[model samples]
Target: MASNIPKFRFLTAAQVRRLHGTLIANAQPTQPALLESAVQSPLNIKYYNNEQNLFQLAASLPEKIMKNHAYQDGNKRTALVAADMFLKINGYKLQETPLQTGNVSQDLENAHVAVCTNAWTAEELGRFYEQSAKAIEEWTPEILAYRNEATEY
Candidate 1:
């Protein structure tokens, strides 16, 4: 039943902005309508569309946030962290993606660029997220410390 599907913790539009400030740059929004809608999309999906996979639900953050170009700049960077934060809040992390030459980060970056260019659809990115997802316990020192410190936002 759809009711049995777990409700995942979501980032607020406020949090998305906070993240944009923290990760991308410290700035105020002159026009925030699109950013707000992007951040809230997952909630709409959970309650109305009923996605069951946490990773797939998490994928919506970066997808919409980037696609909408939620910020004046660094929309790509913000979209990445926003999605990662969503996963972290709900007890997950994306595993290190593999690459042929062995530098996984490049592979992930390529995916982001492809998405930005519309070469890959949101569903493709969603699958990338789902396939890479791992429990927090499974993570090592971690991709970086951005999500480590606590904040009021």
Candidate 2:
């Protein structure tokens, strides 16, 4: 079903490549098909194929990216960053407060492992994303920069 909500942003393959170069030391996909699959995950009908539910969108990245093995390495890192970036572009962010506990990197690591291994229920990967994603009223500056760059291409 189409959503009545306002439009949302999604990352392109080129943007993912740029992120890979900066954060993972590799800019190219080892398996181009897998990279495309991972990049297009949020649009899968099982994930609702719309902008109505942010959780569905946020939940799509780690599993596909981790399992797809798109790049030579750093798939887990890319999954985390991609999920966070997707959310930020759509007006949500992974926010942490002083009262929250546990190591975020560890949490993300555990979540990604659970996603790949199909033990997500035990690891509560949903909780990790749910706890972190907070919606805001304005577009993030990074997303604006991305919009500008996307237009230049």
Candidate 3:
């Protein structure tokens, strides 16, 4: 039997950043394209409709849209930005991503796909749009602190 769970791979902050930037750039043509391509694209719209599906797809590191770096210094930001745009285009409202400061850990072995070391997993990125979602609601402030502490290492 094959497992449906995507394998989790630890990534450097740079790698994650690159991934984020790529996704946003790839889907740049449409305003809120996540809705159109993800919802009305000629292929696989149903899967994009559910939260789990979005998580599975986002967690899958090998996805083309998830790995195409189109900008400097903001891959993860870009990915979330693109995801937000996609969702909005498809009729979903999302909150803006918080400010990011460089300071991720050099220890990539334990890294998870979160907005930052203290945020939720990249798979949970949709929570930003979910009603009453609190995972990353105030995480930017903590992340800023984390960045400060990280610089000393």
Cα-based TM-score, every candidate: 0.77, 0.76, 0.31
lDDT tens string, model 3, 55-115? 3333333122333433344444554543333332223323443223332212111223344
Give the Cα-based TM-score of candidate 1 against the true structure: 0.77
lDDT against the true structure, per candidate, is: 0.69, 0.67, 0.34
TM-score-best of 2 and 3: 2
Q: Which number leads on TM-score?
A: 1
User: Which window of 10 residues has the lowest lDDT sum in candidate 3?
Assistant: 103-112
Off by over 4 Å in 3: 1-68, 96-123, 132-153
- After superposition, which runs of candidate 1 have C-alpha atoms over 4 Å from their true positions? 1-3, 95-102, 138-153
- In terms of lDDT, model 1 sits at 0.69
Q: Comparing candidate 1 with candidate 3, which one achieves the higher TM-score?
A: 1
Tens digit per residue, CA lDDT, model 2, 16-89: 77777776675688898898788777756334544446556666766678889988888887877777667666
Tell me which residue pairs clash in candidate 1. Answer: none
- The sequence of per-residue lDDT tens digits that candidate 1 reaches over residues 1-153 is 355556567777777787777666898554598888887878777767777777777777788888888567887777777777778767776533222234345555677778888898767877887777677764344323333432212
Q: How many backbone clashes does candidate 1 have?
A: 0
